[model samples]
Each structure stands twice: as C-alpha cells, then as structure tokens.
Target: MHGVRIETDRLILRPTAADDFDAWAECMADPEVNRFLGGPQPRAVAWRNFMTMAGCWSLQGFGMFSVIERSTGRWVGRLGPWHPEGWPGDEIGWGLMRDTWGKGYASEGAAATMDWAFDTLGWTQVIHSINPENHASIGVARKLGSTLLGPGKLPAPFEDDVVDLWGQTREQWFARRRR
Candidate 1:
C-alpha cells in the first residue's frame, strides 16, 4: 500500500509513485543538484534509486517523500525521515531540484517532516549526513537547528565518503521550535 501524504502551505509531499519517474530522474540527472549526492546519475541508475525510496516505504514504513509544489503541481524532489539498515542514526533528509533552491521549501518541508518523525514515528533523535564540501545543505541543517556532531561514515557504496553528522534530539527540536 502507498504511504501517507503530508501537505504544507505551499507543497504536497507523498510517497514516491511510479508516475513520478520522469521528474525524479530529471532531478537525479541535474549536475548542479546532484553534485554532492553521488553526482549526476543516468536515467537507468535513477530508476534503481527511485525504487529504493519507494521500497523503503513498503518495507520499513517510512522514507523520503516526493515533494510537489502545490501551485504548479511539479515534483520538486524527495525529503523526509529516512533510516535504512545499517544507518548511522535516524535522519530527516532532503534533496530539492536546483530550481527549487532558495525558496525555503527545504526548510519548510523539513520542519513538517521533523514534526512527523518525532510525533508519529517516535524517534528521539535525528542525524543528517552531509559532505564537507556541501555548504548549501549545511546551511539548511543550520536553519533546522542542527549542528555538527562529529564525523561519520555511511554504509556500502558510500563507505569511503566520510560525512559530518549534524543533528539534534527530538527534545532539542521541540525546544528550538518553542522559541
């Protein structure tokens, strides 16, 4: 079954669907957007990666959501809570198309995502795996009230790429929200 959907003032986020392949693939192929995310992948590779996110929903009950701009009904990218097998920690991550950058969509989606993760998923903490050179994402993390927690490594395929783990506990997130 398909996972639940989340709506914000300007966006609609839902579980990845097969029909989203085109927009999803395009996002993966954009070098500007894909620079720090394993580089621009071919359409074929994007398909496999696409399935992984969709599969995570069926197999794990949660994963990235295909974000859509409500005004245009355009699939922007994927963003949400994700914690796969062998993950370093629970995380609410994001990757928006280059065109969607600077619009506060990531920050908006992240706030809603973190709320769901903490209130519904019952997660006590969240971590963001960010490459050192990825300054854009680092800004987003800071906007979300996350700070570097030291170095960490991802599981296979990304094992060699060390990342800075940035995050905060659910208590911390809520406490930040109150202010």
Candidate 2:
C-alpha cells in the first residue's frame, strides 16, 4: 500500500487506505453505481468487503488501487490488477462513484493499471469480467482495445450471473500502445 503508486493525467492509483473508507462506503452505497456491482452494501458489509481488497494487497502483494483525483485529492474509485482465489482470470476491473461517471475516469485509470499489470506484474494477458448488461464497462473495455472473449464464469456468489469476458494479450497491448 505504501510503495506502488500510479499517476495518470488526472488521477492517482494506489492501494486502498483507512482514510478512503468513508468515500469508498459512499460509492458502495450508491444503488445506481452498485447496480452491477452486486448491489449496494450496508456500511458494515462494505467494511468487510473493503478489507478484502486490503487483505489482497497484504497477502498477494497486488490488488485493486483506490483511485484518487489529482486535482482535488478525492477518492474517486478502485480499479487495477486483481485475481482473487477462484477468479476467472487476471482481471483489471473498475467501479467509480456515480458523480464521476461520464468523465472518462474509469478508462483513464484502467489504462494505467493495465500497463502496471503487464509490465510490472509480468502478466501475459488481462481480462475485464464485465456484466453483459454493463454497457458502460463494455465501452471502457472496448476503449482499452480489448475484444470480447465470450462468456466467462465467476466463483460462488457470482457463478450464475451473466459475465462477458473482454481482454487482450500483453503483445496486443504493447502493439496498441505503440500507435
């Protein structure tokens, strides 16, 4: 949580922190924002879920980064390399606050994390486990140059849900970045 940090044109990406909790909880509480993210969670539940992300960093050394706005130092969202136990693949996912929607923050932050996952983490590929109905995420994946990899599976709680996997190989990522 202390060492790794990513800065994009308008955002900073780093591990989740205690100070980010209230904003994180607020984002999780937004029904519209959480609509595709397993629904709004109560503060107590969100706390547990939030700790899961932090735990990943402690144990796995890499997890979703708590996104911050560069200009305002505001907690905007979380997005980055994530592959929890029983996960579908090495995924780069995102979930932002409702107020931050339509601002290109998701794609902007995701692009930086994709680079970190591939170049630093040495991942061969990365995927975005997007809900079929989550058009906004579909658009972000498309914007990142990932193509549909067909329907995918999620573990336990999300196993029955419809998720479309979108991804690109590291080779493809570098090729696209060259242009």
Candidate 3:
C-alpha cells in the first residue's frame, strides 16, 4: 500500500498495517462496538474484513485509516474515505473500539477525513451510510456538518438493510470550514 498518513491533535491516521490486526479483531469481536456494524464477528471473519480494507488501499489508493492514539500509540479505530464497488457514493465511515466511545475520536477523525476526501481526493461530495438506530454515529455525522439525505441501500448481503445517507457537498464543506 502506498504510504498515507494524517495527523490530528491526538491521533495519527495511517493505512492499515499488519500489526493492527489483533486490536482490529478485538474491536470486531465486541458486540456493542459491532452492533451497528453487522454484529460481533469471529476472528476468522474479522480477518477477512481486515483484508478487505487493506485491499481497498492497494486497489483504490484510498481506504479507512488505522486510527492510532498519538499519546499511547494504540490502535483506536479506522475512519476515512471509502467507496467500495456498488456503494451509495463517496463515503467517509468510522468504527472505533467500545472503550473509546465517548471521547469524540469519531468526530475528530472523521472531520480530518472529510477534509482529505474533498481536498486530497477532489471528491465532489461525501456521504455516510449510517444505520438509523445508530444515534452515536448520527451525532458524529452532524458534528461534521453533514445533513440527512434520506434512506439508502448497501450492496449484496446488506442490500436488505436500511441506512440513511448523510453528507455535504464540497462547497458546503468548505463553507462550513470558513465558519
């Protein structure tokens, strides 16, 4: 994978590395953390999912960044620009460990990712496919200045699942930044 790194005040966002698998697997195993992300998956399934993210980087040159805490150098979560085949649109998604829930890492990391998507990738717009029941994620989306764009569907196995599309255009994003 090509090197890509983003730094926030307390976080270091970079491409997924081999060393991040254990923590990533642990995060996927937690039911509460995975509740909106299709429930807790076994280690084997987690491995496949992890590889998928890594593959996205190799093939597309962009994928969720392995979010790490700068102070402790811990893998906190993954969040960044992602647009898999059959996805709704250019999306900036996030999933963090349950232990790190209330600290605002999702919003912090997502804010930076949004900037990267629009500025670096030159995306015209960015969307977040969020489960309606996932209030926490909805809150993060709002914090990032994205507005709800009604219901949307995912590809394949998730096609039957319901999600709301929330996002802002590049102009809106830059406008928000000026405020």
Candidate 4:
C-alpha cells in the first residue's frame, strides 16, 4: 500500500485515522458540504463512510487522504483519489469543511495529491467527476488545469443527475508544472 504523506504550504494530506471521526462527521453532516452530495448524511452514515475510506488503502492501494491543517493538526476534510462503486477509472475527489472554504486549501491539497499521483504512482490521467450544479468543485477542477470532457455517465447505481467529467493527463500536468 502507498503510505504517502503529501504536504502543502498550509496543509498536510495524510492517511485517515480513527481520531478523524468527529471532524469527518462534521464535514459530512454540513449542508453546504453535502449540497452536491444529495444532502447531508447522518452521523452514523458518515462514520461508515470514513471507515470505508480508511479501508480503501488496503483494498485499492491508494485512497483518499484526510486533509489536516498543519498548524493545528486538525482534520479539515478529505482530498485524494477514489474509485466509487462504478467509476470507470480512478478519480480525484475533495471536500473541505464549510468553515474552511474559499481559503485555497482545497486547491492546494488537490494540487499536491495530483503531483503525487503522477510522480509517485505514475498515473497517466486522473478524472474528477462532479455534479453538474456544483460550481465550487468545477472551479477546483479548472484550478488543477483539468479540462471539461462534457457530460458523462458514472457506472450503474449512480443517480440520473448527469455529472460533468474533467480530466488532466500526465502530459498536461507536467506542462503546467513546468510553467
């Protein structure tokens, strides 16, 4: 398994731990955070989701990293790669507490994760699928230099709400890094 720890100017992206339950629950329960997630799930459901993420490292080799504020060493949210139930390929996903929004933490953490995915995992391309109406997440994709690939379907079991797929290839990432 990849025991990767990514660091940004103000955040440390590390593996999720048991102690993250409260923060994770808070973020997951926030209406703003779940606005595009089909509404806030209950605390119990959020805890289950956290466990699933913690287990993904063993099951998938790479999984979502909990975003922690370096200065406070507190969980801010989660950011990294994930493979949802029917996703065509590995996807990069991110979510931060509403209180932490608009501070560039999401972009910073995501950019760091993207660098790790390309340089360490050698992933040639990464996909980010977001609800069509989630403009905030769409902006994050653009900030990472990803291009909208138009409407796309995530495999079975997903709702009919079409998601916008954004992708960034290794070549594009390298070019951006060189800039």
> Could you give candidate 3's per-residue lDDT for residues 47-82 as a string of tens digits?
999999999899898999999999999998899999
Runs in model 1 deviating more than 4 A are: 1-3
Lowest lDDT sum, 10 consecutive residues, model 1, at 1-10
List, residue by residue over 75-170, the lDDT tens digit for candidate 1. 999999899888899988899999889999998999899998899889999999999899889999999999999998899988988699999999
Give the poorly placed runs of model 3, Cα more than 4 Å off.
none
**Local distance difference test scores for all models:** 0.92, 0.93, 0.94, 0.86
Candidate 4 per-residue lDDT, tens place, 28-94, comes to 9999898876679799999888989988877867788999999998899998888867776667889
Number of the candidate with higher lDDT, 2 or 4 = 2
Clash count, predicted structure 3: 0
Worst lDDT 10-window in candidate 4: 152-161
Clashes of 2: 0
lDDT of 4: 0.86
| Candidate 3 overall lDDT versus native | 0.94
Give per-model TM-scores. 0.97, 0.98, 0.98, 0.94
Which clashing pairs does model 1 show?
A: none
